[model samples]
Target: MNQFTHINASGEANMVDVSAKAETVREARAEAFVHMAAETLELIVSGQHHKGDVFATARIAGIQAAKKTWDLIPLCHPCYFEVEVQLEAIPAENKVRIESCCKLAGKTGVEMEALTAASVAALTIYDMCKAVQKDMVISQVRLLEKTGGKSGHFKVEA
Candidate 1:
């Protein structure tokens, strides 16, 4: 059976010790989707929403969330990283697609940071547009790619 990295021999949860690990350039990319009604999508794409610049708000939220991931998640090490978040209003799909990337030179990977960024960005969109549409659904949050660290490189298969 595979052992859990956050568990100890005593079956207690604990943060992994990465002090001995070598620091390297690590990067991770993650994605999320927020599905909504056609009218809601139209409001976002047409830039007529009263809330003002949904994409810009979401982008800032994602970047802030990435930097604070260590504080939000238990057992995660504090890391300094650069983050980029992009959100697109896809009217054809009636949804907003969010992609986030986090990069850092550190002992641990930045996958969690990237994932958190994407998730928060999606949530921010929902919060901003709830007055216009309350039934929005956030889904398909996943890590799309990762590079560096001991794991080397990984990318989702098309």
Candidate 2:
């Protein structure tokens, strides 16, 4: 069996050395789902969230989260990145879909960054709408696709 890359035989966490790993342009995308009351969804669609400009605020939070992924996840390397965050509200179903794409030039891919951005954006949605929809739930934060780097490309097909 393969040992956990981040853990040593001594059961201590260790940062993986990537000194010999080739540098490459890498990109990754992640997605998340936020479920809320249909009435709240309608309000969001009508630009009625208690906080103004939900989409704009969530987008900025996602970008900031992507840039700070390393600080949040101890093992992750701090990477310089380019990122885009897209939010689509489904008023009919009282849900929102958040997608975040992250790119970087480094030895390791930015999959964690993308995933973190998606998760943070989803939480931001829940936070911004909690007063109106206390039951809001954030779910299904996951990596959708990734490309470049040593591992090559991966896609989580629907």
Candidate 3:
């Protein structure tokens, strides 16, 4: 059976030691979807929402979240990295899609940071539009791709 990296032989949870691991260039991308009503989408796309630029605000939130991932999630190692977040409003689909990418030269992967960025961006969208639509749903928050580390590369199948 495969052993859990975060679990010791005594079944106690612990942070994985990466001190001996070589620092290498690592990159990860994550995505999230915020589903909302057509009217809410219109309010955002038409620039009629009182909240100003929804996409821009969400993008900033995502980037900030990526940088603070270690503080948000326990056991995550802090690393210096670059992050990019993009948010698109699709009126026809009645949803906003967020994509976040994090890169750095570190022993640990940045998948959590990417995922946190996407998730936080989605939540920011929902928060900005909550006054207009209360039923907004956040979903499909997952890592889309990752590169580097001992595990190599990974890409989600469409």
Candidates in order have lDDT scores of 0.95, 0.89, 0.93
lDDT of 1: 0.95
Instruction: Put down candidate 2 lDDT per residue, 7-115, tens digits, no spaces.
Output: 9779999998888998899999999999988888887788877688887888999999999989999998877889999999887777999999998888988999999
Candidate 3 vs. truth: CA RMSD?
Answer: 1.0
Worst 10 residues of 1 by lDDT: 1-10
**Candidate 3: Cα lDDT at 137:** 96
Report the number of the highest-TM-score candidate: 1
Q: How large is the C-alpha RMSD of every model relative to the true structure?
A: 0.9, 1.3, 1.0
Candidate 1 C-alpha lDDT tens digits along 16-95? 99999999999999999999999988888888889998999999999999999999999899999899999988888899
Q: CA lDDT of 34 in candidate 3?
A: 96
Off by over 4 Å in 1: none
- After aligning candidate 3 to the native by TM-score, how far in Å is the CA of 4 from where it should be? 1.8
Cand. 2 Cα-lDDT? 0.89
TM-scores for all candidates?
0.97, 0.94, 0.96
